[model samples]
Target chain A: MKWKLLFELFVVFFKIGPISFGGGYAMIPLIEREIIDKKKWIRSEEVSEVFAIAGTAPGAIAVNAAIFIGYRLAGFLGALAAMIGVLLPTTAIVMLLGSLYFLFKDNALVEGAFLGIRAAVVGLITYAGIKVARTSIIDKPTFILFFLILLSLLFLHLNPILAIFIGALAGILTMTAKKKIQQKREEKTHFQNKQIREISK
Target chain B: MILINLSLLFLFIGVISFGGGFAMIPVIEAEVTKRGWLTTSEYTDIIAVAGMAPGSIASNSATLVGYHVAGVPGAIVSSIAITFPSLILILLIAVSFNKINQSPLFHSIFYGLRPIVTGLILFAAIKFAISNGLIASTFSWQMVILLSIFALSLFVLLYYKAHPVLVILASGIVGAVIFS
Candidate 1:
């Protein structure tokens, strides 16, 4: 890969950073606009491939997407520059907001507003869970996994990370087991059909 | 010492933060809550501030929590720590030309991971509910206010599909009105 045309990469991501209003997903179209539509940094079809990898990767999709594009366009330094550009504005904003919250947190009005916001946050997080669950909890086995994991966290105080590993294991083990069972059943039916045909003969 | 601790913890959080955004909340909640670094209310407040800001909510929360615990250096360390894992992972993938996204093994892993994330987020919601005195063994007036806000927020988010930023802003205003 070519090394270091990183400055232009940095400026593009920096411009793209603040446009992420709703979440990382919302910023995707903008990324599409900048990376594909405007700059033609990568081919249009490859944009989905980039996003798919970005989604599979750990951390925020916006940052991951930027990193992917940067590396493809320039190199290691390009990836680094894009990351800094994406995070630079937002980190400063979070610090500023956080500092202000600390300053005013003691005031009665501020405290009250937080109380309402806190309750609402609970609501929002629940909404997010449900949104994910709509697609995740499709089958009986999945429902069981969902319930078990939730129980483990709430009661057993299982490590959340550990719970995640268990969930992945359960998915693979159960899915593989189901496939094996189906294969065996099909083989048995085939043998039974052969025997019945011979008896008829 | 605190910075070191921040880096290690956030680095781990960064790697496991699959599905991204709110999906990672319970992991952050469990970690910070376990360490007793911040109270549930304080953490909830961090989330609120983070949600209002642009960019990833989880990353922003990490920044706020780090700041709250140990000031600006803490913030920088934690932010970088949370982000570093993915940067390295993607960089390696980009360099290697490995096709992880297209592989069956990777898809199976995510298929399993997704539901677990769903459960974790729900657990986070319940934690907030219980900690804030909203869900008690016995009822109280505080429960009523909390439930009211909770219900309204859910309704707006679900039915109207309002932007989360708007929902948070409205909630803050309501909090100031009622609590003041």
Candidate 2:
């Protein structure tokens, strides 16, 4: 029974692996359909929670998600099976393509194809930038933060690790300050209401 | 030596790659260039291929870089190295997911980190454009072709919401026909 379940896990993820282009986000809906809707492996809400956790965790979102889902279903071994299954197709495909690219890299025809592909890649990356920006740059502070980071990266050539660290620190400091101010305001309002009630009494 | 370095480098990248594969590109570019494994344009080619291929772009690129550096065994090592951190992290998170998710501080950090990630991705876009000659010092026919391709790709992705694989394939066809 255990082996059958493991095999099923492998097969399911292996099937989902190849068609999951455009990164992990693209694979989420398909994973949901197969795991939640079709297989009844987990609830839709649970899947969403998994996604949130996956987003926050380090590594590829897809791999983290697969591990969470697999662990939820059948513990560590199941997680390994799911991860291996999902990774296999892409690994094979990439290895094959990578080898081919190396072999023909100097070919004029191949070079031409890459040139065109590279141009289109610019568009793809730009679209990704805009998509994330739309959701993340929601207000003035975030907008300023965004441009500040951009300038640091573009001109100052800041190390990405340093940038990420600075961003996290700024986030913690600003958010904590905001929360403290909010608490003070609430306390003051509460004190005023209490005084009014005592006077009326 | 190369394998060890590649493994260690990818392992570090995997650990710090917060906003998914796109956010990792600049870091990967920095490392690969610094190591003298590939030139900037060559690395961009890997990025293009990685974008077109399956799985995570970071992993795919790692595998390609490993392969470039040492061969199939090198590829395996680098891929494993890149993936290892996430596996360990996810397992830890799975055990304590409730505690982690309930923290307001966690949410706050992400709120700040998200916009920074957005900026990093945009930087990647600009870097690729400049390196690939999409944004040139002087305008020419090649620039026109590139801009048209860029506009067409952006429109298709935004308006029609076409799958990225299809967009990449279409771009490759356009490249083969016109640029050739």
lDDT of each: 0.86, 0.85
Name model 1 segments beyond 4 Å from true: A1-4, B95-98
TM-score of each: 0.95, 0.94
Docking class of 2: medium
- Residue pairs with clashing backbones, model 1: A113-B175, A113-B176
lDDT tens readout by residue for model 2, B69-120: 8999988898889988887888898888889888888878877888888988
Location of the lowest summed lDDT over 10 successive residues in candidate 1 chain B: B95-104
Q: What is the DockQ of candidate 1?
A: 0.78
Judging by DockQ against the true structure, name the best candidate: 1
Measured by TM-score, the strongest candidate is: 1
lDDT of 2 by residue, A1-201 (tens): 988888888888898888778777878889888998999999887877888888878777787888778778888888888888888888889889999899998887788888888877878888888988888888887888899999999999998778888888878987898899999999999999999999999
TM-score of chain A of 1: 0.92
